[model samples]
Target: MFSGGGSHACFRDCVEGVAMTCTYNFTITASTAMSYLCGDCPNNVSACSNPSCIAAGGIVRPVTVVNNRIPGPGIQVN
Candidate 1:
């Protein structure tokens, strides 16, 4: 089990053929702005530092994510 910086509970390594249960909780919040490295703008590494950079195509649009991660966490079961 993995946590993306949020509260979570998980169970793993259960005995084979045994019954087990796993539970997870997530918080939903409004979208937030985030900056990512721009491959094409190597000369302008600080472009995303400005809040308005998103409007100028220097940053990605605000988005809602789980545990502050785009794809969230992963779980495995046996």
Candidate 2:
């Protein structure tokens, strides 16, 4: 999930917004350093326009994980 369109723009604006899967376990006593910022989806490629980038060794955009879980038991169930 890479999104940063403030300077010029090359390839970093593919956001579906909403995804965290859940799975954390970090215990090291102390001494941390975590940072992540990517919020700029005015259009976000026309709201996710088909562009998975078939192949090329790299380039498979599509990331938006950050859910902490709360609506379990099959939400909506549809």
Candidate 3:
């Protein structure tokens, strides 16, 4: 089974029946955004425009992500 959301848990028991092969294709590209909440913050708000707002508050910079996800997608097999 294949799942997305950047979870690290195993999903072996989530699927039933015979085992099958799963293939996934991803494209990497350069992207820019106003802000990306990398971690916990006050009231879940962020000021990416501020240069000082790094890490938890996120920053306005070039980022490379998988399938347009920050933590990338998750893959599971059984």
Candidate 4:
């Protein structure tokens, strides 16, 4: 859920200028490709004041299947 500061900052500034608080909604896709981009935050190049809000990991494991009907050699879920 990373938002570009350009539009967001402008919107926020506009709303705040009117003495109102702005509510922003965002969605983040957790995938390998988005690994470098932190979730719910701006680009890494730009410093995020509240760094704790960003997602820590973006890696997803591939589903494993053994043979045709059985689980893999060491596959176990608890």
User: Which residue pairs collide in model 3, if any?
Assistant: none
Tell me the number of clashing residue pairs for each predicted model: 0, 4, 0, 2
Model 3 worst lDDT run, 10 consecutive residues: 48-57
Residues 1-78, candidate 1, lDDT per residue (tens digit)? 335333433445667687766666665544544444333342465654443223233345676655444455665553
Off by over 4 Å in 3: 1-17, 35-57
Query: Any residue pairs clashing in model 1, and if so which?
Result: none
* True-vs-predicted CA distance for residue 20, candidate 1, Å: 1.9
> How many angstroms is residue 57 displaced in model 2 relative to the true structure, after the best TM-score fit?
39
Please name the candidate that would achieve the greatest lDDT relative to the true structure.
Answer: 3
Task: Give residue 67's lDDT in candidate 2 (0 to 100).
Answer: 26
lDDT pick, better of 2 and 4: 4
Q: Judged by TM-score relative to the true structure, which candidate is superior, 1 or 4?
A: 1
Report the Cα lDDT for residue 31, model 4.
30
User: What Cα-based lDDT does every candidate model obtain?
Assistant: 0.48, 0.26, 0.49, 0.33
Candidate 4 per-residue C-alpha lDDT over 2-72 given as tens digits, one digit per residue, 9 for 90 to 100? 34344444343333345544454433333332223335334453433333332333233332223211122
Sequence-dependent TM-score of model 3? 0.46
Q: TM-scores, in order shown?
A: 0.44, 0.14, 0.46, 0.24
- Please give, for residues 3-32, the per-residue lDDT of candidate 2 as tens digits: 223422332344568433432332222211
User: Which candidate, 1 or 3, would have the higher TM-score against the true structure?
Assistant: 3
Q: How far in Å is the alpha carbon of 11 misplaced in model 2?
A: 16
